[model samples]
Target: QGKNKKVIILCSVLAVVVLAVVAYMIFKPEEKLAVSTVEVTKQTINETLDTTGTVSTASEQSFTLMNKVKVKTVNVKEGDVVKAGDVLATFDVSSLETALNEKENNYEKALAAYNKAKNSSSSASGKISSTKKQIAELEKEIETLKAKTSTTKPSSTKSDSGVKVSDDLVKRFIKIAKRFGVEYDEATARRVLTSILSAGSSTSDISGLLDNLGTIAGGSGSFDMSAFAQMSGGSSALINAEMSLVQLKAQLATLELQSNDTYLSVYKTVYENAQSEYQKALTQTNEMKKGWIASEKGLVSEVNIKVGETVETQTVVDGKDVDISSIISSISSGIDVSKMISSFFGSDKVGIKVLNYPLVADISLSKYDVLDVSVNQEVSVKSANNEIHEGRVSYVGAVATSTGSSLDLNSIMSGGGSSSTIPAQVTIEDGDKSFIVGTDVDISIITDTQENALVVPVEAIIIDGSDVYVYAYNKDKSTAVKKKVTLGISNDTYYQVLSGVSEGDVLIKNTSGLEDGAKVKLK
Candidate 1:
């Protein structure tokens, strides 16, 4: 009976404790939840496309030697940084000086021979004077003949083959015909030229003539030269006069040559040949004396030959001729032809490779990522060593390369097949020679950016279906107020609030236990 009484008292104590706890939860003052808050403020946000790339030199140039000479000094070694106008190597001038002396002596001998021939020809002045008088008489006779023909025949200006072609129009027709690879003899030329000129410059007429000409030049078509000639309307009188004039002009040219001392041309040719030889030797000697000069600033990537080595000439011999006029013109136009001349002239080919700076990183992007990348976009590059550098997007290729499969955009997006990639490049703005080429690097391209943007932490955002809101802390009511926000571009940690939030607005950092209109206290 005592044990039962004790058990009852213990149960009564437990009931009293449970009743007290329930009363306290139901009747005590409402507890305010402790919450951490953040203030929205203006900040810069950058949306980037992270990728991998390889370090590469922006440009590479190769220099070569163009002479067979003994190298006296080697001024640069591989991996040396050099500047424009720096002498890369020197050559022994002993052999060149001897050659230059020999050239000067030959020139002097040729000049003496030319002067002697010229003096001897001066003694024939009497014969030259007679020839000049004869030429003048012939010119007068040709003029009289032309006058007589013009008076006798009013149509003397037209062709005798019934073709009416002005000399200028004939010239123009010949030019156009040449473009189509067609030509005609003297007589046939006149008729065809006259027909084309008579036809107007309308599209149909010109195109038809071109088509017919193309047929004559081995193209596909049935073109009849006789039919083309039949279209000419010219008189015979004018052609006869023109033929007579041509004969007279030919005779006059012979007389004029005689009157000007014909032997003078022969001697002049010899003298000019000597002069050309001398000039060529001089140009080569001067260049040899200068050795090899750096055309522009670059890092030397190769040094193929050592000092004291004789590089043999590889240029064309007398049997093989090369057109060097264009090469000379290239040099005159400020193009770096030091290396080009070496290759062209078959000179002793010692290549000096140069890597030009501001460095660039080569990377490839998937088809979708390429759309967001463009030239001039800001970028950040990180090397394996944790070194960071600023850069800009320098190039984005338009074409995509397949990776074992071809798929359309819709199919690729829906996971139908493998995607293609496009090549891209970034120019490191602050890059220099210190940046190693062919190294791997990490890059982030800032595809989008916003400055002075109203932003809040992503933790403060509350997303429900299509609605985006944030729990803003109300200082007046000591509660959390739900406010809708229009979002813009976002970075990793913050969202750019385009609307519904102002700078300096307080927001709940996390909405885990917070509800709209819930009482809250700053933690």
Candidate 2:
């Protein structure tokens, strides 16, 4: 009985211990899921884009000949470095010299012709004036004869048949009788001359007065010429006056023809045409004398002619000839020649090609990063041999590339497609001849930057449709709460936090499977 009592007591103690352990296991609270978190901190975020590109000449000047001339010597070849005032090539100027001499002679001839034409015009004006004077003198001589005739008239002091012959009376009778072609007697002729001489009319009026005197001889009536001459000066005086009148009329006709100006105009036109042709030849000769010289310091990108080749401002493209003279002239006009010397080789000089120095890189940007690039932006270039160069964005293509193809370094490095890249230009500040043109190089452009800005790892940010958010870890509650964020520029590893997060704010570093408002433990 004593043994059974001790065994029962032991069994009861064992059962109570087992029941307590089971109760504790069933009542324990659940532990939270552990997560890695990060603190939002102020940091500098440099937004950059990297790509590959080619080094090429930024501004190439093509040296072309405006006239066909034989090359005398080629001082430089392709890839030659040249300085301002360096002679690029020499021409056989024997042709140029001959042309210049011809042009000079032509100009002198043109000038002489112009002067001769001017003198001829002056001489013509003088001839016209002298002819007019001669006509006037002849008219005066005719008037003088009329006066002599009046003085010698037999009926000077009286009228025939007792008719009153007043000075004014005789003049009126003569004028009316002549207009109607009436015959007059010798006494009437004598009276008419007496009246005209008394009036002392001008030479211009005397010619008309003499023409009226024909009335005396108009009819079949017996008005003897001898009787009329006796009343006037004499037959000889009348004949001399009539001859002078005929000579005056002939001279007036000649003067009228000269005033038409057709002859003088022909000479003037010839002079102007000669002058124009001379000027054209002079311009051509002057340019030919210049030969070829470097206008600015640069590398010779091409040398198209041999030592004896005759070159012209023409070139063949796709088997068709084209005039590149105008195009070349247009390019030359844009160069700033202020830094270059005016002459080389004892004459004013210019070249067929003028290449401004320094190097540039041509790169492409994709639609993903095109908006982030612009002119004057900082850039870094790297060669295949790992040489780094500093540069700036000089040109951004305003239109899409026509080929729709480009080498996008960003896409290439990231193993992405390059179909959307647009062309861009970078001026390598310290680039030199060491860089082979058309060779590929790596390029990185500083597209954006932020200083002392709140940022978080790109992985920490969550994309929910159009909204971007992050899980904020609450230190007091030991829980993660969903907080929306406004992001600014982003780099490879982090994003500039614009809003909804502050410096020192804790965030869930990896939100891959984290739930909103879920319990968590700090890592």
Strongest candidate by lDDT: 1
Please give the range of 10 consecutive residues that has the lowest summed lDDT in model 2.
337-346
Q: After superposition, how far is residue 252 of candidate 2 from its true place, in Å?
A: 44
Distance from true location, Cα of 498 in model 1, Å: 1.3
TM-score of 2: 0.39
lDDT of 1 by residue, 1-523 (tens): 9999999999999999999999999999767889999999998998889888898887876655535557788888887888888888787877877655655665676677667656645644445566556556755664665566556744434333453555654555565455444565556666655544433223344344444443223311122234334334333333333333333333333333323443354345445555665676686577668877776777787888778987655433221122222433344367764444334323335446777766789998876788899999999988556778899999999898765675556456678677667988999877655567888788999988899999888899888899999998999989999999999987779889999989889999878877889999888
Candidate 1: which stretches are off by over 4 Å?
A: 1-19, 27-37, 66-297, 307-351, 362-374, 396-411, 414-424, 459-465, 473-482, 509-523
- Distance (Å) between predicted and true CA of 282, model 2? 22
Whole-model lDDT values for every prediction:
0.66, 0.62
User: Model 1 lDDT vs. the true structure?
Assistant: 0.66
